[model samples]
Target: MNRPHYILLPVNPYFITFSLACAFLLNLMPWGRLIGVPDFVALVLLFWNVHQPRKVGMGIAFFLGLLMDVHDASLLGEHALAYTLLSYGAITIHRRVLWMPRGVQVFAVAPLLVVAQLVPFVTRLLMGAAFPGWGYLVHGFVEAALWPLACTLLLMPQRRPANPDDTRPI
Candidate 1:
């Protein structure tokens, strides 16, 4: 049986930057305390780190984390450290993670997301901040659950239609 081939379009750096900025903005929106909202910035960072490691890595993560710190009014450097670690994890497993199907990728990313959440939690605890309660962890799970959606959305711009008339190799 023959299989159809698809081409992946080149990704624009500006698009990546724009998407990250949008995620940061989404994270800053007030969604109330009752619902567990996923960390949009972190999710976008992780997605880019995995799919475009050369373009988005630890530096972006750190900078975004600092932005998050300022926006949320949380302990300084707390999110920076978490995002740096999260970037490391994503870069480390990017090759392997990308080989998996979308559903399995969620499982692969869950631990990294947990680590991103844990660093801030631990930092706050050490700084004498009271435990924010188990509810905090719910966001990480929500982020993990939304991984597939994020991946699909981000990849949309890079997906190219296969042309039957074109003879280029896939």
Candidate 2:
């Protein structure tokens, strides 16, 4: 059972920005308050961080975080802080992560997502907010579960065609 190996082309910077924007908009949907709703921004940010650390770094994460923070109307830096840390973690493991199959990568990325989400939770608690309950933790795993699907969709633009012609060599 060999999966097709794709030689990915260089990613477009514009595409990266577009995907991040889409992810941010996804998060802005009204379903966010529900338990176990995956954080699309975190997932996409981590995806790029894992795949292209040079092109997408913590600075971008910070900017996206600030935007999300404003939209959520929580602590000004809550999302920013979590996203930056998440970017750092992803960049740290990017090399190793790229070598993994999609299934294995899910496990590798799950802990980072969990910790990233935990940052805001802890921050809110420290700032005198009431406990949000244990369900909040499930969102991380939910994001993790979306890893394979995200990888397929996000990498689509960069993937070389399955049938390559002589002139279209990857």
Candidate 3:
């Protein structure tokens, strides 16, 4: 018996930047009235951090988080701190997380997202900002829940045809 072999296509750096830009724009979109809108930029950054740690690491996450702070007019360095920690966590587990199946990967990443969210929330609290209540955590959960979908969409461009001769049974 022969099993189909699939090869992953190389991803362009420009495509990754473009996707991150799109996620930033999505985050900027007005959804103030909504209760639990996910953080698109953080989600994208985390995804890239896990899949391409060499290309997307702490510096990019910090820069992007700073940009997000300016976009949202939030406390300076709040998002930067969170995103930096998030990137660190992702990079630390990049190999292990990549080894897991997609479904398990989602769960594995949830705590990282939560920690990312917690950083900003804690920063705000220390700065005299009022607690936003448990509702604030919903966004992290939403981001985690959408992980599978985001991975599928982002990887679509990287799917390539397998070599005909490479198909072999184990």
| Cα lDDT tens digits for candidate 1, 47-159 | 99998999998998999889888977899899999999999999999999987888889999999998888888888889999888978877788899999999889988887
- The candidate maximizing TM-score is 2
RMSD of 1: 2.8
lDDT of the structure predicted as candidate 2: 0.93
- Cand. 1 TM to true fold: 0.90
User: In order, what is each prediction's RMSD in angstroms?
Assistant: 2.8, 2.3, 3.4
Off by over 4 Å in 2: 1-4, 162-170
lDDT (10s digit) by residue, model 2, range 19-96 = 999999899898767987899999999999999999999999999999999999999999999999999999999999
List ranges where model 3 is wrong by over 4 Å: 1-5, 162-170
lDDT of 3 by residue, 1-170 (tens): 25453467778899999999999999888886155788898899999999899999999999999998897789999999999999999999999987777789989999999888888888889999888887887888889999999999998888744443566532
**Candidate 1 residue spans exceeding 4 A from truth:** 1-5, 32-35, 162-170
Q: Which TM-score value belongs to model 2?
A: 0.92
In TM-score terms, candidate 3 sits at: 0.90
